[model samples]
Target: MACMKLGSKSDAFQRQGQAWFCATGLPSDIIVEVGDMSFHLHKFPLLSRSGVMERLIAEASEEGDEKSCINLPDIPGGPKTFEFVAKFCYGVKLELTASNVVYLRCAAEHLEMTEEHGEGNLISQTETFLNQVVLRNWKDSLRALQTCDDILTYADELQITKRCIESLAMKASTDPNLFGWPITEHGGPMQSPGGSVLWNGISTGARPKNSSIDWWYEDVSTLSFPLYKRLIAVMESRGIRQEVISGSLTSYARKYLPVLNRHQVVNDSSSRLEPVGLGAMVSEEEQRFLLEDIDRLLPMQKGLVPTKFLFGLLRTAMILRASSSCISNLERRIGMQLDQATVEDLLMPNFSYSMETLYNVDCVQRILEHFLAMDQITGGASPCSVDDGQLIGSPSLTPITMVAKLIDGYLAEVAPDVNLKLPKFQALAASVPDYSRPLDDGLYRAIDIYLKSHPWLGESEREQLCRLMDCQKLSLEACTHAAQNERLPLRVVVQVLFFEQLQLRTSIAGCFLVSDNLDGSRQLRSGVAGSSEGGWTTAVRENQVLKVGMDHMRMRVCELEKECLTMRQEIEKLGRVKGSSAWENVSKKLGLKMKSQMCSAQEGSVSKQKNGNGKNRHGKHKKTFTPDPEA
Candidate 1:
């Protein structure tokens, strides 16, 4: 049910006013409420337009409710869209635009306003609107597809998603530089200095609640899986690599890809070359365009090409009757056709096909054949070649070298899905050069992804694989973790830091510090075969560091002793210059006399004491009679 500005054919008349619909000056029998909006109108028109409304009215009457209002909870659109649908049902001409077309179409479909009674009705008009207006512009079509929250349910119900995708695809393929349209220009792409402009308002861990994701990055989050696959497939067919597309979209979803929850009833359309189930074989002109699109990808990184496009290219090749033709001739044709841009765009990945892609796109196989064919066409083995092992290897430091190492580990480590994944991985590993040192950030990341997928791996096996990693490039956290592990030798972990100072000192002073392990200290120290139990034993590493420091301290001690002796001699010479030696001799004699008197006092004799006045050496004691006379 929708709330529109219902006018009189009733006992009262209403005009468009700034009050609530129910509060407006209209005498109405029934009030229909949809969300916060209410439509005060006669029940007759609603019954005629919507069976849903008719059923609600019938239920209300049976319940004999005093309120003659029917409330539609959980309806699709807001009040504005409902108003548009209401007016359309009342025979009002609807003005459709890209902004409101998707929502309006769904609203019409929900209200059953599209069921025509011969003449052109709202539904027929909507169909015409879609074909004539929405389908014509790539921006409008994608906007409708992504902006419409219920597009999957509504578009699926109306069976328009596939049609919309098809139309969008046609428009996209016709454009130059098909993938970067709207964003890309003759010089560059439309992006902020930092990244895409969409990254401005939203960031990681922050998004508005209750609002559907609307940015280009999050736009795909609302699409069904099949629709998402179709979108990617179609774009790739136009010569847009998945890497470019995914990289652009990944700006908002920076850490990872947004998970899109698809509708359960989404149709499964598998047997098609193009996305949206476009027929397998395109027209000859279209094929030329497709071939031209494939031609554009040459001279670029082969890894940049999405497997889906490879599949589409292969499918097109098969349909063009080129798959069965001599691949060498095809290579010659490619060279002849694109002399200026001739380079190997397609080449075998170092890893297995399935591991490289979500679907079994045989991207690796096709690239290998292309490379091989190019080699044969040129009449010489390519820089990369296939050996007797069916393994592909190249001397250049291409991305495949790293992928080969990854495949080797992935095959040996992962066990559950290995049956479906083994042969390809084995071949990839075999292709890797024996002397190839896997020591890049990407290689480590690939290894991490593989190990994370298999949680039950034994510790020793994990350690062995990880040992191959370049410790210098390891992250700070990884270094800390490796240092803490009991299995790894402390020396090895410390050595991985590659500190020249630590190695230099440890190499020289083998056992300067006290050793935690006694027997090992003797073995560790050079020229010290005899072990001293519970003595000044030190580890081999700490020896050099301590010896240097301790030797400097001993030399410093000798210098300090010489300085103290010189200061003492200077003090004695100053005393002699002042003639204080005579006072010293007198004081020494007086001290000896005092000491003899103290010895006599211990034998019950009185000892004399000297004062500053030098009058008496002893003080007299008064007898009892003498003290009385003196008082």
Candidate 2:
């Protein structure tokens, strides 16, 4: 701390209880009563340096009052600071520091101790020390600003608060390392000004090399909210980066808002300070206002703040009972960069009194809507584009795809909540555009979870929820799960079977294409018999997994074929009783028979191919069946 000694003389005042009497052995000519304390002194020193005191003394004399007492009921800093002022007037030794400079300045201003009363009055002396010593140092400036809260009106009138805030802002905006100030990253050891690395006062003898922009966050976080607000405005007006401002805001919130420390969202940096207990440091109402103010001050740009931090703010907002607008603003911001959020970030527990679900499903739905709105406004180009009259996938869909996956995972997490209504579940599932999901595996899992938790959903309701998934997009594993899942509507299981069969056929056709290519290669290199045989053997070795998969798929298709046959037989029996409607329903719902027969024939031919070898006269193996070009 910076200190300025004002008086050269030894202490010449004695305090007997609340009354301080000068020790010059002269009868007291004047008494200045400040709150509970009284200063008894001669008139010469008080009259020379204090304009207000001189006028009060003259006014008392003019009123024909013999008493020489003057009461300073509204004196800034009250009796404690008045004691310093009294000592200065009497030329007793007095030391002024950053901690007390603001108090002395405000008190001096209140007493009208200006240069007009003396050559170098208390006001001018404090101002010079503040400008030259206190404001020039980072910690000193913060300390001075913190002291202004007790005498806000006087400090504002004298511009001490403004000067201190501006000084702190200037220092905060500059790189602390540029001027040899000790700098520390979040959660790292704080370095003392003496260049010693300190963690609870243990020296590690290691100095940090690079400085972070958050070096001033801890220092400035100690200021009162009003002063901090002014400092932030000044920094913003001076063109400080938004990211820096955001970091400071996050730091301040972490220190002052206790809920953030308790929330599940992982902060980018661990708070360097301990969690402040609610009602201990700030009242609940004050915390609420602080959160709203911080929300208002956040940068409007996207990607500048972390999504997790936004979630933390939102959770805290709900706990603090912040204004509706503040909560909405947080949701919009979260939506703007929602692709960066994880499932855990969106798992905010229901805080409403209604308590409809385990998690706030409706809030997440709104956030998803905001994300979609932003995507639409930015002309979210579709991931698929036409090339040569055929649509192809593009990388432009990365963000929406990520969000889709994130939402699917979130849905699965909330699916177990029985209180989550069916419509709400369906709405959230359908929020992401169809184009965004190239694969429905994640969506299927979530839907399946919802179905498992909600067994009471009727067949029609289950089908309606299942419609959100495109069967063609299901991975083989999901297809297998869906095929055996009795909880799914029978119609959905049929669709899953049909798509699974179709996907298997496509795989078999691909294998046929590769076999044809290999055969062509073998024919072309027949003259090099050893090389040809070696290459053929290597190709077969590489495709062993594909052949195994084909075998499993062929068996699955055959089982589906038998299932279709059984279903057809049952439909025929129903048609005899229910007229032609059952036949028509079979035609519409069980369209898998023809494809199943095709798979059967293909499997038969493959079996025949393995059992019998078709060798030419030259003893070279020959392909027995011709591939259908359409296949």
Each candidate structure's TM-score, on Cα atoms with residue i matched to residue i, is 0.34, 0.81
Worst 10 residues of 1 by lDDT: 607-616
Q: With candidate 1 superimposed using the best TM-score fit, by how many Å does residue 342's alpha carbon deviate from the native?
A: 28
Clashing pairs counted in every model? 7, 0
- Give the alpha carbon lDDT tens digit for every residue of 461-529 in model 2: 998898999987887678767766768876677666656656555555555556556556656676566
Residue-level lDDT of model 1, residues 319-377, one tens digit each, is 34443433333343332222122112332222333354432314433343454344446
lDDT of 2: 0.76
Q: Model-by-model lDDT, in order?
A: 0.43, 0.76
